[model samples]
Target: MSSEIAKYVSECFIKPKYEVQEAKQPYYLAPMDLGMLFAHYIQQGLLFAKPSNLGDEQFSIHKLLQSLKDSLSLTLVHFYPLAGQLTSLMDEAGQKCLVYVDCNKGPGARFIHATLDMTISDILLPTDVPEVVQSFFDHEGAVNYDGHYMSLLTIKVTELLDGVFIGCSMNHALGDGTSYWHFWNVWSEIHRAKAGESVPVSRMPIHNRWFPDGYGPAIYLPLIQPDDFISLQEKPDQLRVRIFHFSSDSIAKLKAKANEEHNHNNTSSEISSFQALSALYWRSIIRALNLAHDQVTNCRLTTNNRHRLNPPLPQEYFGNCIGALKTTTTVGELLEHNLGWAASLLHQSVTNYGDKVVRDFIHRWLHSPAVFKLDVLTDCYSVMMGSSPRFDMYGNEFGLGKAVAVRRGYANKFVGKVTSYPGVEGGGSVDLEICLPPHSMEALESDEDFMNVVSLPLKG
Candidate 1:
């Protein structure tokens, strides 16, 4: 190890607080597997052009590893109790929190070994330029966290591509997607500050104390068993993401038709757009599932748990504030009934999950030990839908023209998926992503009526 790297290690890892305890579940429960969760961290993730004047200025991987050991020393001081059995939620601690993977030798292959107390610095960010910064942020690691809290993977300058993705793999149970994003953003700010950058204020996240009660105008949900996790591994094939563009006019007409039948005067609402398209494609999926005669198949909608809380959870509060609502019907009913009826059902399901239901669900969830089974429910899952019109797919200014393709790689096998709403031009239209199995998708794609309904323009 280089002397500089060694010194960094000594300062970061050799002298920090530490904690060790048998992993256990806390009150905030989501569907989860009771096992150790894992994630990855990468050090020196970007490759940069060497300085022309300096013949061979390079970093030592061995010494970098030493620095990694030192940086991990900080985790001990910040450890917190694991909540909801989410391995991702465990506060940073020294015990079983870090590992090392040497992938320098080859691809489709790598070797891993545990480090005593791997500090965050052990995974160094490139000092060369912002280009390396973006690369390191983009494509450096993969899901390898299993049976451990965290692991660190270090690549030398020789191993990095023009861009690399480097981040931790955390159990969703530990935190929601919002929390995860917050964690990364904070980590970056802290690292930058340590490097003498003037980082501003850091915000502490609001800890979750609210609960979700499952009680409602009781709908039929197949009780899930403990073995459901094993069954989940064998999902159906229709889980891949497919992108489709709909003209503004088409969506508008669809919303008009939906509002007219459902008596919703406001045709230009996020809820309306989502409901219109979801109903159209869901009807198509029913056809594909060969359930044209059965009437119990349903579509699941994704609900943000933010406003469902008592007094409404703060938007800035980081954690999973998302839940799913199931809208059930048979192919016979959908084909037999008009789209308005379907839309009404969709509307009612969402409306029902308002503040009252949300607060109750959270409260009951806190006291209930009856594990909610996700397996039995997957057989007839809801079509998940949400909107993200402002996701900056092009904001990643890594010097290359903005990302030409921003794809969500989710093999949703046996799961229903929907996209965040991509609002219409002038923020008028609503665009969404739909992911379903091939056969179901083919049915939806071929439905002339469904297309006509969804294609109506914003003003139509």
Candidate 2:
């Protein structure tokens, strides 16, 4: 074993805690035709790291799969031939299912292998990107596919080719970004446990049938018509995802200036450092589009609903425990203000999605026959989310070293993908990654004012 692997062995060990919740059958309440939407995403498995050098002894995926054989099961959830219902599963009950393949197994390794027998591009990775320790961000693979919700890039890690790209392809029904990471944590933990290492406790499972009171699924979500359901259409337009880094000093200066400006607006409370950065990007985007600064749009946050809703969900209740915190503003309004002032407006929108409101909203939306699609939030040109603690690149251990690159992507349905990070500086540093139309990206990169704020060095 490599010295790095030795360290993992020396570290303290804790019994693995796997929390299992009854998987609910979502078929009953979910719109029948909506299965097509699920099909769209599930078919495309998430792409994670594509590590090179499968020959590595410690971190090789092939070896890792061998280790997993004793602890996990791989199989498919096949639909019946006659009934055509997803009535039968191919694995033993309570056994976790994962699939492994090579070029000759079936199709190319680029396709995701899942227990459900779905061949979605939901999970895939390109092997060319640099490793986490070298680049810290895989610029090419960290992206969501068209019509899909999240970017799932799978990188292969082997001694011969030592690069790894890690990511997931998740459906909105399974949960938002928060739930996606939660699942990763568990997968990692289980892998570690089987390797004779210790992992933190796992979160509880959410049965597919489980339904909370509120909304029934509105109009079929995947937007598939009756005839279109059976036959898939051409691949939807793809969303472009990119990652950009910023420095701590630059973020602080921007926040200070924003605060000074907010004082003029008669706002007493301070805005978060994130709000300050968001305002700048918002303006840059507007400038890129040549749209009026005052054009009204919404900025959404994926609020953690674990604590807010009625009968707070258990810490183990791991699924899509998230709802959007929406804020409406004009490009002019956001650009006209400083960070502090912009932050206040952003905060107000977030505060609106409290426990009571979120529960009620979920109940109402799910109960309605017409499913509320992305259109409600997409009308606005941009949607931004910030302060994700779960995106901890340093914590993930594929054994080479820390991840060199970590970034977000656009899901194609929306025009924008903006995510901010706490700065590397001890004080308050922020990093923002925005995915926009290729033309919009070019326009923003050229803006003098936008460049002034974001100008910073790479984290390492």
Candidate 3:
């Protein structure tokens, strides 16, 4: 909250608009194995853009709002579940349980209209994530599946001096990042299509929860108990959110170095750009913290199982198809090992995620209730990384130009979370949005190894 940002907060208004639900029948989405794990969380992001290149002839506040509202309705035809809400209901056995989404009671997604007295450049051009940028999002409280069922998605349209900002808030229990982006892409396509232009055949989403043969429906009935869920509210502390850019060339160099070091031990497996970058960050953070030699450290990499499933899910499969692959080592081992060693650890974890492994995970969840009580933040020395460099973040164009910058609205809340996105400048560059405590972030800023490859564009 800086004085500069406060100046632009003079005028703002929120108008809620609801669309008509297109789906007729009541759709009961029992939490899929993956969905149940994230039943209490939400995913949010903001897409910033300058005014549409079409000028006033095609792009105006009124036109933009109408297009968004209409296209969202059309998009709901394919993503109907998003227009619904999550609820806790009693099963035939009289057992209370939570459903991922209840489409029977539908009010559609929330469409908000807002105006800001600022320009897009004032936000996007900054190297760091600007606090004021968050104002564009709908500040609705956290989702409560046990209580009142609210909209699964909300979109906020903010008019800036030179552009418009589209902010999206989605319930994680309904879907994952892939589903979120899929809905956005389809909505954008429908918005850009001309009156006579036929809407492209959208890849229909698959909702059936996958299970191995012989598993009874009761196994997935209630994946979480009332005492197992944790509040989505963030811990109270000051965290520094910084965006670090790594160019294609830098990533390539890091990959080459990792491969060279790994080959020295005669291992045929090579590290990917993602593994290399992640390893680098892990090492940098450990060095910055200067932890004790015996301190245990771990990395939790979010792995998508859509393709890794036994038969592979449909390309259009929605909902949570994600799992975490974790690797652990003592602080001393990490500090003593070369970059390749750390990268190989990550590479091996990903390579080990085969069909059987995923199935085993489901079986464990079915039998074990303690898994639901596991706290992600219980381990202080762990870092959780998510998102992918391959996500088409810049491809979202709603009859306007491509987004100049893409950012997550809630990433700053997780203390040791790191999310990666394709750089706004395009090419093979990567931008990592990292959230860390003030001391850890300050240490990272001064870490020579990290500074060598990361470009801190905002720092003087």
Q: Per-residue lDDT for 1-460 in model 1, tens only?
A: 1112111111111222233232122333232211111212212111122122323544443443333333223321121222111122222452221111111111211112122122222223221112222222211333223212222212121212132122233344344444544443443334334433223435555544333345321111123232434443343553434445466667677777777776654444343766776777676556655653754677776566666666787754644566667787777887677776788778778777777776565555534423334454456434555434433222222212222222232222234556643433334445455666656666666777765555432321
Candidate 2: Cα lDDT at 454: 64
Q: lDDT, candidate 2, residue 62?
A: 50
For model 3, the stretches where C-alpha displacement exceeds 4 angstroms are 2-42, 52-58, 92-95, 98-100, 125-127, 139-141, 144-148, 196-198, 216-231, 234-236, 369-374, 456-460
Winner by TM-score between candidate 2 and candidate 1: 2
Candidate 1 stretches greater than 4 Å from native? 1-169, 180-198, 201-204, 208-228, 238-240, 247-250, 264-271, 380-382, 386-402, 421-433, 452-460
The lDDT for every candidate, in the order shown, is 0.41, 0.43, 0.68
The top-ranked prediction according to TM-score is 3
Lowest summed lDDT across 10 adjacent residues in model 2 is found at: 74-83
**lDDT for model 1, on a 0 to 1 scale?**
0.41
lDDT of 2 by residue, 46-154 (tens): 2233344435444455554344332222101110010111211224443321111110112111212111111112111221111121211111222211222122222
What's the C-alpha lDDT at position 183 in model 1? 47
Winner by lDDT: 3
Of candidates 3 and 1, the better by lDDT: 3
Alpha-carbon TM-score of each model against the true structure? 0.56, 0.63, 0.87
Each prediction's total of clashing residue pairs, residues at least 3 apart in sequence or on different chains, is 52, 85, 0
